[model samples]
Each structure stands twice: as C-alpha cells, then as structure tokens.
Target: MIPFPESTLLVPRTLFGRGKITALPALGREFGPRGLLVYGASFRRSVAYGRLHDAARGLVEWAEWEHPGGEPTLDQADALRAAAQTARAGWIAAIGGGSVLDLGKTAAGLFHETAPTAAFHAGQTPRHAGIPFLAAPTTAGTGAEATPNAVLTDSNTALKKSIRDDRFMARAVILDGGLLSGSPAHVIAHAGMDAFTQALEAFISVKSNATSDALALTALGLIAAALPPVFAHADAPEADALMAGSHLAGIALAQARLGVIHGLAHPLGAFYHLPHGLVCALCLPAAIALNRTAMGDKYMRLSETVGGDFATVTNTLLATLQIQNPFKGQPLLRKNEILDQTLSSGSTMANPKRITPADVEFLLSRLFV
Candidate 1:
C-alpha cells in the first residue's frame, strides 16, 4: 500500500484536552499581536467565550466578528475579509462549528487576494498567502480545524463548494471538549453522524493511502464508541473521545478526500437550507449500499471496527439519535443541478465505487421516499 498521499497537508500543531482553548491567545501571538476572532452566537454567549477573552486580555489584540447565521457564504467571507483588514489582523482564529470556521478560514486565506471571493469559489487559484489561521471547533464534526478547504455558498448562484489552497490549512488547532458542552442534543447527534460519515468515507476513498487508512479506521472506532453517549448527553465523559475522533476524521478526509455523501451534502444542504450534518446523516446509508460492492474486504473491516455490520450500526445509531428522514415527503428540488454537481465533485470522484448518474438518481430516490 502507498505509505501516504503523494501530496499531504496537515495542521502543523494541535493542542488537545479540557482547557486547551485558553492557549489560543498564546498561540495567536506566534503570528502577531493583532488577530480577528470569529464565532457563532451560541459561543458568543457561552462562558467559554468569557474565558477565551480573559485569556486574550493582555496577550493579543482581537477584533470579534460574530457569524450571523446560516451557512458560510461568499458574501459573508468578503465581509469578514474586510473586517480583518480593518483590524489589521495578522491572524484569524475561529471557534465554533463548521460554518464559522469556514468563514474565518476563507477570510484569512483570502486576506491578500485582489479578486472577489466568488472568483476563488469558482476555482481560481489564490495568488497570495493568507494570514495565519487558527481553529478551535465547537462541534465534534466538520473537522474544519484540520482541513485546507473552506466550504462556502455563493448566494447569487446557490452553489455551495469549497475554496481550497494548501495554505488554507490551519497553522494550529485546539481540541477541547469544554467547547462541546453547550451544544444542543440535536446538534450533537447531527454532528456525530457527520463525523462518522467522514471517517467512513475517508477509509473507503480511492485516494486513501496507508497512513490515511490507519487514521480513518482509528477515527471510525473512536466516533462509533463515543458518539451515542455524547449525543444523549453533550457533557458525557466520552465527549473528549468524540472530539478527538472528529478531528482525526477531518485529518483523514483532508488526506484521502471523501465520497458521494459529502459530494451530495454540499449542494443538497445549500439548496434546501438544511443543516450540512443532517444531509450527511440522511445520505450515508444510501452511499454505503452504493459503495459496498467495491469496498470488498474493507467493508467487513469497517463493520468490525464499528462493532456490528456497518449498515445495521448506522441505522441503529440514527434511530437512537432520533434522526428521521426529512426528505421523505418533499419534492426533489433542482434535480439536474444536484446531479451535475454530485458527478463533478472532488469528493464524489474519490468514491470507492465510480459513481454514475443512475447511482445518484438511485440515492435521491431513496431519500425522497
């Protein structure tokens, strides 16, 4: 097996544990004294936010930008870029879910770019290096902290996609279970499923290498064991394991890429204004069935890792988390558009099974009914 990806990018430094967040200010100081802090509403109101600010007090100069709501958007990114510029920030640190991190990551990555955010989202290469980006994920999913890509939506076109540059990778990451304590049960459930899906997809990705496979399998095991308890109780003792699993899943996916579930999640979530993790949860079983044949022995390996047949484990978890099919009775919107995007996605192309139009149609059909 290939030892590693022909090319690999990873977060250069990571700090993990209960109060690791307090280190953010010190970490950002490595970049410069001035920085921008991006976060979501819930985080802004939480006590951890106060603790973060207390730590930042004399160590760094931080300008705050609250992610207003909804998915990360090109417009929002541009606004954040402007905010960082106005603050003369030397780095950007985001502490929240995937959307908040994506916004901050995009802003920092594009801080020196001359063109519109849309240009990069449309596939233009970044012409300049961005300020240092640091991440602390509040959710146990997305692993935005470990990736070199930021998924954003272009509201004008309703296209949700990633703007990736090797330089977009975080300079440092803080994985603290303290950040996960305040997330609602639904958020925990959805994010846990998303993390599991990411780990599984990375394990089965055609681009997966020996190193990525090992990391993905470890992540799968950790998430499978920790997710259910964490979903039932956000502050469960296993939350730390869940957070570690999510981070590992992010790293694995960054190296190995993902499958159609992620490929489809982007467009479907954007079009329907659904939560991204929810979309991944709803699409995963179908993807498993689609890729099972090609997965061969690895499929059984995954089953064993998760402590049951993969399909049965996933369905059981979904039910335990009270995840219902939201698309069951809804009309399929933008079918042609969704199909086109799914076929062309970087994630879809990495599927263990080569995905066809018929396969995408089949997956959609399963969801709608």
Candidate 2:
C-alpha cells in the first residue's frame, strides 16, 4: 500500500463555466462595496470588459488599475498596494492573465505591510492579511487564481521569485471560457504548454501527495487532449477543457510543488525576458529526459492516460506550436549562472531525483538547438 503523504490543499471558492465572469459583481460584494479592479491593458477594449462594467455598475464601487503587462515586478506590486490603499479599497479583483492576477494578489497581501515588497520577496513574514481578493483569469495558463503564491520579478536583482503565503489565496475565482475566445493562437499555444508542463512536473514531484497526484493526472490528460486543438483554433470547443485543465494544474502545483522545469524556467525568464510558458516549453524535453529514470513508472502511466509517450507528445506539441529553442542562436546566460539559480530554486528541491549542478549543466546544453 502507498504511504499517505502529508500535505495541505488550499483553494478558493471557484465559479467555473462559460459566463462565470458575469458573477464577479455579486461575488465582489461579498468582500465589500469598494473594490480595486485590476486588469490587463488590452481587456479595456474587449466586450467582456463592457459586460463586467455593466454587471458591476451600482453594485460595487471600483477603481480600475491596468496591469503593465509581463511578469509582475516588486515596484508594480508596491504601486498597486499604494493605489489600493489610496482608494481605501475594501477588496481586490483581478480579471486578466496570470501576470495581472499575480500583481493583484501581491497588492492585496502587501497593502498593510510597511516594508518594501522586496522584503517579502526576501523572506519577510506577513503580519496581516490585506483584504478579500478575487480573480478571474482570462488566460488558461499559470492558474494564478488557485495559488497562494504570487511570483514577482525583483527589479533590483532581475530574478523571478515568489512571495508565498496562505493569505494570498483568492476568496473566490471566476473561470469564464468566454474570456478565452479572443486569445491569439500563439497565446493559446504558449499558455497551454505552461499548463501542461506544470501538470507533468507536479505529478512527478517528490512532494506530491495523493490529492495532488490525482489532480495532476486529470489535468495532464485534459491538457494533452485539449491543448493542440485550442492552439490550432483558439475558440475551439476544447477551450473550456484547456482552461479547467490549467486551473487544476495550478492547484496541483500549489500543493505538490513543481520540478526542474520551473527551477530552470524562473531564472531563464529573469535573464532572457522570455515568456514563462515558452521557457517551460524550451526546458521540458530536457528536464523530462533528466528525470526519466526516477519518473519512469509515473511517465508510463501519464503516457497511457494522454495516449502518447511523454517525449513524443511533447515534441509533437512543440512542433505544432512552432516553439523552438530560444537558446539556439546565442547563449542568454552562462552555465554556472543557470546552475546557480536552478540549485537555489524551491522547485529544484521538490524534484524526485537529486539534481546536481552537473545535471543542470547537461540540461542547459541540450536546450540549444
């Protein structure tokens, strides 16, 4: 019999469906009347934005804050916290991609903290929870809504790290498939890969418990089936499946933690300014290969569930999405630099196999075309 693993599973009250975003106003009112609305810069131009505005009218007073777009920074988090304080916001609501959600979560968690956001990034413990937070993720990647960690880039060090706390968990999450209708094909591809990688990594993580393992397997199956179709045609019927899969992956990773793919992706993203999902995609095959011995049984199970071997499925997906190695033409950072960051990352510690600097160096060497 498998031994029971010690773990804690935390998730928001999730409202998932095609038009669930319309429920934001009613949900927002649960926290308070005045809310800080954080969203993507491009969302203001969408019909969904108008719908959200119409739903929120007279129900909740809100001040809109546009996400600067990209990975969130400490400065951005600080500014958002200040804005929320200035507005005297009773709650925070984010409706956009992962970056926007991370910013919103960070802002809400930091609103009452007097120290710099970097302090939290550097292991400062939060003494107080800011306010009720809600998230409506427009993208199917990152699953930021389900996580209690807000990943931000430290502007000073240019390194990506997370301020993790149970207080960062959303009070509620709105998953609307309708919001995904307008996503570009490349966005779908990149984000889908990120979700897929998260699921795979979580499944094989040493820290994975039974609950996370079950969720990760389900998520991986859905993602494997749904990502290609959605990537080829953004508004496909499979879009909702991909969205759900991504959310599940996020929850799985939140509990199970991730592996070498995320360990390497974080620093690579910091150094190269590449999209997070793209970085995961670039590192996945090599990471999988490195962990193959330790992960063989789990990988075989995943292959059966997903209807293809891990490497074959990943390569095919990469080809379908037209994702090539970003490190092909020029090296972004030295091997030692990548190795150092990889070794220091929390994800690396969760890897099923012991990862040495030599292993990371080998993985980096394979990332080049």
Candidate 3:
C-alpha cells in the first residue's frame, strides 16, 4: 500500500462564505495594484462580476480577459500571459468555470517563462514562480482552484494534458456559494458529476493515503447528497455543500491522483469535444464495474458513504440528472490515438486495478456500443 502523504500541494489561504467574492479586490491588494481578472461569459452576465468590478473600481487596476467558449487551449494560456505581461500585473485571478481557471492558472504559472506554452505542456520544467494566482470558482466543480496542475488542450496537436509545477498552486481561493448561483442547471449537473468522479476516484486510488481517504470520503458524501438538489435548483441552500465538496475533492485528488475514468475522460473528451464532466459521468458505471473486485473493502465503504450500493446509486443519479450516453452509436474515431493516450495517462497508472489494453478496449466497447 502507498504510505500516507507526508507532503501535499495546497492553496495557502482560503476564504469561504456566501458573499466571499466581494472580498476579491481586498485580496488583490496584497499582491499589488495591477492584476489580471480572467473569466467566462457566464460570469460576466452575473451580478457577482459587477460586485467584483465595483469593489475593484479604485483599488485594483484589473485587466479583464474574457474567455471565448470551449475547452481551454494552449493558445488561450499564451494570450492570457501576454495580457498579464502587458499590464505588468502583480497577480492573476480567475473567476469562472474550470476552463477559465485552468487558463488563468496556466498563464500565471508561465508568466515569467520565456518558453512557448507548448513547451511547458510538453513537459518542460518551469524555473520561475509565477505571479500569485487567486481563484473564485463560478461553478461547483473541477476544483481547479485547489490544484497546482492546469489541464489544457493544444489545438496544434489536438492533445489534452496537464502541466504541473509546485509553484503553480493557487495563492488564495475564495469559495463563495453566490458564484454558483449563476450556473445553469446543465452546468451544475455536469460539473457536479466531475466532482463526484474525482472524489470517488481519489478515494479508491492505489496511491490513496490516510489524509486523502478522509478528505475524499467526506467529499463524496457531500457531493452525493448535495448534487441533485443543487442541480434541481441552482439557488438551493445545498449549493454551499456542493461547492465545498468539489473543492475538497480537488484537494484530495491532488494528493491521491485518480484512476482510469480520468485517464479515459481526457482522451475521449478531447477527441469528441464532449464536456469533461459528462465524459466522467458516462464512464463512472463502467469504471465501478471494472474496479469493484479490486477495490476490496474500500468499495463497501464508498457504497455506505453514498447510501446503498455505489454503482446503483451512480446510475440512478445519472438518470436523475438526465445524463445520457453520447458515445453510443458514434463511430470510434482515432481509435489507436485514444488507446495510446489513455494507456499512457498518469491517472491510469494510479487505478486501484491496474489498467491494461484489454481493460481500455472493454471500456471503449461499452461507450461506443
């Protein structure tokens, strides 16, 4: 068994409350007067953005960059880095969904690096500590705020992968339920599933330890109980729990890593342009079935935590949220490429059951129908 995690990556300071987003400007002051604020259209339409902007009116010189819709890409990170450099920004704060946060985090982490963004994505080590990165998540998923790695797609190569550096960790995180209020029901559902999968995968990971197990289990319970309500009503009081659950799941996964679902999700989502969470949600049942025997007693622990058999509960939850399998009946494009990437993933290596090419083929067979 993997030993307990003695050292872990973490966000140093975190503020949590319903209205904590209003405090962003004050927090930005700690870094300096100039900063970059990265966000998506959904955030821009919300009242929270106004609150953030009004609060920063005289205090922070924020260069705002709005992310055009779609998965985050290397070019987006490069553009953000250029914007930050041009503004001579002392800090970078992202307030949006996972894509926005990943882009912001990547740009901030590479702010001082002279190498192209692709080089870092290709595993080049970053030698500089980036400007401070502060995160306020608008959606209750991804946990990007709590992790030091940024997963971005390279449009040139059509590859999706993470670039990690200890210095890439967020300097501060604001978990405000108010931000979640603006998320669409579908966004809430997809993101919630992503969080649930992360928590579950981390809990059962071969690399899991004492600290990660504790956190991941708690995260699982919280997300399991709160996701449905939050999905049904964005302003539900359960939003707070969902947000916190997602954050804790992110923190846990940072230490324990994940499993084959994530391994498959990255490659499949990249190839099909599917949302990350949707891919995770679709992959859950098959993953649970694949790993059930290998999970040992931990599988029972998960079932108890989520109330009843975990696999049955997951299918019920997916149906409750109207999550359908999109991969069924689609032609399996880039089969070899997808197989190679999934088999090579770091997350795949961390699976409770060692994933083989046959295991991946089985998963693909289930998805492609």
Residue 175, candidate 3: how far off, in angstroms? Answer: 0.4
**Model 2, TM vs. native:** 0.97
Give lDDT tens digits, candidate 1, residues 83-105.
Answer: 99999999999999999999999
Quality of model 3 by C-alpha lDDT: 0.92
TM-score of 3: 0.98
TM-score of every prediction relative to native: 0.98, 0.97, 0.98
What is the lDDT of every predicted structure here? 0.92, 0.87, 0.92
**Off by more than 4 A, model 1:** none
Clashing pairs in 2: none
List ranges where model 3 is wrong by over 4 Å.
1-3
Summarize candidate 3's per-residue lDDT along 1-369 as a digit string, tens digits.
Answer: 555796888788999989899899999999999899999998898988888888888887888899998999989888888998998889999999999999999989989998989999988999988899999998879999999999999987779999999898999999998788968898999999999999999999988998899999999999999999989899898999999999999999999999999999998999899999999999988899999999999988999999999999999999999998888899999999988999999999999999999999999898988
lDDT for model 1, please. 0.92
Considering only N, C-alpha and C atoms within 3 Å, which residue pairs clash in candidate 1?
none
Which runs in model 2 stand beyond 4 Å of their true positions?
1-5
